[model samples]
Target: MPVTPGGKASDGTRADAGALAGVEECEEAPDVSLEALGSVATTTDASPGTVVPGSPAGTPAGPVSGTSPDREAAGTGSGRDTPVERLEDPGNSATERGTGRPGVAEKTLEQALPSVLADGPPKVLAELARAPQRSRAVRRDGLRRMGIATGLVALLAVVFCAVQVLRPLPGPALVMTGAPSYTIAGAPLTPAWPGEGEAAVEVEGVGSLGAYGDQKPIPTGSMAKVMTAYVVLQDHPLKNGDDGPVIAVDAQTAKESTAPGESTAVVAEGQRFTERQMLQLMLIPSGNNIARLLSRWDAGSDAAFLGRMSGAARQLGMNDTTYTDPSGLDAGTRSTAVDQIRLARAAMQDPTFSAVVAMPRVTIAGVGQIDNNNTDLVDPGVIGIKTGSTSAAGGNLMWAAQQTVGGSKQLILGVVMAQHSAGASDYGLAKALAVSQKLINQVRKALTCTTVVHRGEVVGYLDDGVGGRAPVVAGADLTVIGWPGQSTQLTLSAPVTGLPHRAKAGTTVGTIALRTGQAAGTEVPVVLQHDMTTPGLSQRIARLR
Candidate 1:
């Protein structure tokens, strides 16, 4: 009996026909099994001559036909080989069946590559571990260099700050230079007279109150003629008895002074007189020709004399004053009240200047001289200053007086310039006198020596020494104010009364004024005005009774 390739009986062979034969054939098929077909397969081949278990082939080299389980499986099934499972025991353990080779399952990329890379160390750490080591000495040197650089930077910052703090920028330095603050005791030192004019109060040491108006510039009229006289007296001294000095009136002076529509002393042409008489005519009569004659004599011409006037004014600190002509007739001659007061203060200091200006009359030596017509200065206490008039400058006047208080004599100067009205010249003069008198009284009341003395044998000897039952006169007519108190110091602003200059009878002799205190305060007249000469004893005693 033959078996088919599919492990079935052959076509001509019967199942019973080959029962014994088929059994032999089946036993032989195990030796020719498909397990022997694959190359390099580890399974053992069971072919011819192989042994079988429980078979008549003697060694049992081959499986028995129909009795061996493997032979039965190969014979009954189709020819394809099936997988083999080894049996360890009757009830086999499945774990014992695996081969020594790992049964590795198939892996996706997601699980394999990522797991490998993640488990490895980073490349940078690996490289650093292989780098060279720095020595301890090199590390110390680097730290020291860093510390030095930091300290140098900090030192530079401190040096810059010190330089900025110590240095000073250049500019102007701080300093101060001026007069100490002082107050004049009186009513706010008003323009003593009205409407911005110049006044010349007679003063000693400084000269007539010419500097008063010098503060402001304005045209001066007849008053400038007085300045012309002032300049002449600066050079020549006029004695009271020396009436023979020759004063030739030049032709030019005669023509210019007596020109049509000009103010004149009416000196005849070519007339000659003493210097003393010319000064008297110039001042007492307000003579224009006399001013011209004297100017020419002193400085060679009126124009030259005016030059000296300017120089004198500048020397006296009259910065605002200017003189275009000798007589103030030319509206160009001008000054302020402040400058005029200065000039007057200067004039009162000079005995000769005071005498010439105060005289009411003079006797000419050679030909013609005139009596003074300035009635304003006739009063003994009313010292002659100067007067001026013009169409533009108007009427102006300045005067001064002296009075005694507490046995001390003082002088008060006043001025009125540029009173612009017709027939107002005397009005300014009267106003000046009235204001000055008031000032004198205010100062006297404030003085420390305001002692009241009744009419008696002698209250005290006057500077003039005209003694008798000296009439008790009010220092200044206390019209504006009744009285002033103590704590006010009255000093003689100028000098003692009866100062040897030609003065009027019953003229104000001195000005009594209070001292300026810590703050600006008031000043008034303290002593009484008196005549230069006193009356007889009978008249004084009558007044006393």
Candidate 2:
């Protein structure tokens, strides 16, 4: 066999060499060895009786014209039958030969020239070339479906957002309407002792203990005089009490201050007493007459003092208090328990007010000092405050007390107004005292004890129950009821407005006035329980020592 290097056929005959005469023999009788020719053409020529091994062993064979390159070329001519050869060669099977069997033909104009001129183009051949472009069309349909799906998803998202935006929120967190602190210990503290009304002790930045009967307007008895004294003291101080400035009792005061079944300092018409003497009579004795005198000295008339009282009430936001006279003798002074608590907190801020209210007794230079009649404050823990009594207004009083809690000082104010009247025995002073005791007990129970630090050391406890029992802090002066459970709203007012930092612990800070509705509320002493001053480096170092 002759072989060509580099996969070429060289000058070899094709498989059809024996089937046809040679080219030179085409013009004459050809002389060729079929066997030699068949060998070169890659075919077999066997006798009728011979057998090929891979074929049926005993089968007689014809001239074998196995698949050859020429046969494939021949099928392209004559527009004749082209055997639909199974595109795969089963015997050689793709995996056995590294060069796999031919796939579906992809016809091009240049390579398919002969077929194009014959029966146009085979339908299968034309379609085979178009398969790739048709695949793109299928992918386009999928993209269209995905686009529609995305649009539906976006629409649903928008609808959900709209529904959420249109919905409403929950309602306000309210437990009860109106004030709830009045029903303390099964008694009312409004318009009288244990009278029904709202009240609270609000230490700024700390929580409030009680919130009851803050809206009612009821008589506050002699407690109204607290406002009168507060206003007078705010505007005027004793002109050197030892010198004893003559305060002539005016006729208008004697007439206006007189109330049926109301106590007076027994101030006679034109009777003169020092301002200091008047204050003792007014606060210690709870004298309606002396209140009138102080009012006349400061505002020139009880009506003027009453007007100032109302104005002050408005400034302090005592919306429920009303005042007709400064003495609280029941020409119609009124307030709620809560308003009185406000007034008490405001009055307790003044140093002088605290001193005056806390003194057990005092003697005037010109006139002999009267007894401090408020025995309720004589209790060791009690701090004496002001008291008021009148038949119409009932017995009313404001007092403050202190106790240790969580290593800190906690102050409490108790107020009583419109208490049940005792039948003419010392003007219900005894009943007022009883009411004060009851109020004190309620306050002590309401206080939640906790500990707090002052100046980096554990000082005391705060009763406000705001958590951590931190240091007790009172920003303004606070007033308390001299009597217990007085029903009236309290409003706080300061003469100079806001307080200063670095106020000494125990320093008077502001006023707590107790009153009922739009009336001048009574004032009480309020003091600082903790130091608010920031220390300098030197001061801090010294403190360490």
Candidate 3:
């Protein structure tokens, strides 16, 4: 144990005092122990029977040569034949320490940690550094997905913008300003009244002239057949010359034809007749039985046909009219004079109905040649319309006449209802004809065609924004049939300031609407009287004030 100057042992061995001092200094370390260090430092002198500190009780010390008895027993001193030693000792060099035991310098606190947590601060710092990298990777993935969504949204927006840019534009909207009104200069012509009846006259395009007496519903003897013919023609349509669908005359129709006091057309059972021929027999001869027969053939029943007749009356604006039966033989069938005129106007619109009513006589296969009972058909300018007469209805006539008024053929539709003669011998037919003739003469004398706007006449002006105005003139002679000395209203429609910079002379600029009385007005196209040219900029600027 004697120390030399170099701190060696008395036997000239190195004392290892410095290494033991180094091990003592390491005793201040949290994981190193003095007991564990003493065990390693005393290992050089320790006998095989000596126990080491901090080792398990009875754990024998190894040989000082750092070899074990097992190595001696094996009679070999190879490098693998070494004994285990404590790790807290710094006295032993790493070369002296056996490979079976980890040296204190080699086994650090970090290396002594459990295998699961063997990596210490540097490993944690490395993992922390890698944490940011992992976070960045996640963020990058999220950003990549967000960028793809943004790209898709941007693509959709681009497509929508392209569609909108390529879509067509609509035209400018035009606004309607006003319509025209009128005032008649003199007293309007009035029609003569038949006895105990109402009368109304309606010109084709000129509305109703006037109505006399109360328009009360009155019985129509045979005139209800006109509606029967109208409904049948509407359901089974007949062209001007086309013979329509055929209908067989059944036994019920033949029996009804022969009933007393009923107008008959001599139809036999099993007789087949075209719809046109049936209409001729019904309307021209005022056949009541044929009207019923037509009703049955068209609608399969008289009650259903009567429903259609009533519905047709309502549609024609005949508010005061009612039909209880298809034939006027039923006294319950009633209509007013004004309502009858409405019906006549609608019926005459059909060319076949008009032609059939105009016939003075018609010949049928079953019945001999039957003359039209409407005596008014023979009168000049008087067209055939249905006529009705009975004790309950007196006399009813729905008449249409084409009379020359102001050099234009004007259609005059009039209705006279409930006319009666003093005696039964003189029926009301003569009275109705006299009254109709008087009204026709009066209307013809009252109306005259007047030129409201002549061709090339200026009706309006188009402003050029510089004090210059271009005249808008009528393109054609605008004439309308109106009452004499009546005031005509002229309404002009044109763009006030939006005229093109350069316009041709014949370019249509507006319309001149001429109205006389309460009728629908006639329109004439208004054109530029002369070419319109834009004013110079200097002129426009000068007029800016």
Candidate 4:
């Protein structure tokens, strides 16, 4: 071997050739093509260059003797520049040459492939890399789309459920109107009417028993004082047992005690009486003077009190009545039998008025004693309301009587107006009392103790709209004092929320009122005799009205 001046020979000797084309000391590369192979994916133990290549080379790394300084600065300092890893294409440079070590990743992928490949594993591996990736991408996209569709369907189902639960639903229909009477059968109540004058009587809470004679406005005598008393009590009310405010008797009213042709309470000038005592004087004794004094006391003046009385009459639906004098002394003061009965009904409701009028006689501190003009009060059933009579105003009596039958009291109110002839009050009042008592007795006889509904009896039915129903029945035996042959109408109802789905046997679903006429009679609770049930979920949802 020889060495040149700047070159070495194969024997480590200097070569003296300055000319080219001599036998060059060259070593041969592996007896194989490396340029056609893929770059190595494994890392080396030695440190790599500072910069990485943009794309991987299709050749393994090796040392280079002929590299420029610029190439070294660009980080390709030697042919052994660090090889960039390639996922897209794998290499078999180690597998093809026994001289290099393969990476764990490369060896595992190569071992898994079939050994029957004639072209070796690298090319086939490269070809199949993108196919599996596309398949995986398509499968992932399909799963994502399915999940989104499933979530949307679930959201719609939830919204649909919320709408069904939140919407309002209406209750059941009312089915108790115009239904037949629920009472037991009884004989017809044909109470006879008064033969003379005009008369009308009503069984309290029941319809009018009868209306007799020509109905027209006529003089009501002291019976019109009932209005005066009612107006006074309204202005200054006194409950039963309350003596009420004191009232002074003026000289004019006291002087009238001796007045002829007129009834008067014996009161002295400057004398005072409790309101109850004064009312007794005005009502029981039928004192025209007391009535006048009351008008003055209650309303500052007689005219104002008279206006109040007229207004009260109008309010009570007594359109047929007209008030002239508070004492009924004026013949101009007039009312019909029906109108007087209206006053009797309302006046009897006052405890003080009824208590005062019921007394047959009362003793006073100043006046020795006074007697009720209506002698019929001696009878227990004949309750005194008022009795009025004058030369112009015929005998008129507004009376209330009650009778107990089957543990229930029945009140009968009757008015007999224009009784007898217009003359002295003695005979007129006597006639009024006699006729009113007779009418009351007739009503008592006609009032039959009747059971409108029996406990456990079906008053009506609650239809569930699905061919099912529960019986709504009386909670107790409803015994009402109604006339015979009169039908008692029954009413059954529930709340706007409809009947409850489940109820006990005795749950009060609604009220059953037996109306005898325009008047509302005894009200008994209509209960669920059987356990009531509600509709199913589907049926309830369907009933959205």
Best by TM-score: 4
Model 1, residue 182: what's the lDDT? 28
Clashes of each: 79, 106, 0, 9
lDDT of 2 by residue, 1-545 (tens): 22222111246532222221122222222222222122223212222222112222223222223545543333323333222222224554423233443443322121222222122123223433355556688999999999999999999977865554443322111111123222113243222235543334432212344554445787787778678767876776543324236678778657745555667665557777765567677888677767766777788776787789998888777888999888776657888767777777777776667667787777765446667767877776777677766666555667777765445556677666555555765556567677677666655544433111112222223221111122333333333322233344443333465444344566554444444333443345444456545333333223312
Reference-based lDDT, each prediction: 0.49, 0.52, 0.67, 0.68
**Span of ten consecutive residues with least summed lDDT in model 3:** 109-118
Looking at candidate 1, the ten consecutive residues that score lowest on lDDT are 171-180
Candidate order, lDDT descending: 4, 3, 2, 1
The TM-score that candidate 4 achieves is 0.66
Candidate 1 TM-score over all chains jointly: 0.44
lDDT of 1 by residue, 520-545 (tens): 22332323234434343333333322
Sorted on TM-score, best first, the list reads 4, 3, 2, 1
lDDT of 1: 0.49
Per-candidate RMSD, Å: 31.6, 18.1, 19.6, 16.6
Model 3: what TM-score?
0.62
Q: Cα lDDT of model 2 overall?
A: 0.52
Clashing pairs in 4: 2-13, 2-14, 2-15, 3-13, 3-14, 3-15, 4-14, 4-15, 222-388
Please state the error at residue 119 of candidate 2 in Å.
Answer: 17
Candidate 2: where are CA atoms >4 Å away?
1-112, 115-215, 237-261, 266-277, 441-545
lDDT of 3: 0.67
Give a tens-digit lDDT track for model 4, residues 1-545: 32222233457643322221111222221211222232322222211121111213322121123445443343433344443443223556344344364442332221221121223333434444445666689999999999999999999977865665566544444355335565546667675665677888888787777788787888888887889889988999986478999988899998998898888888899998999989888887788999999999999898999899999998889999899899988988988888887888888888988888888899988887888888888888887778877766567788888888778787788888776754453646687777777777777776777766678778776666533467787788877666666666666657555676567788788777777744787777777778867666666444444
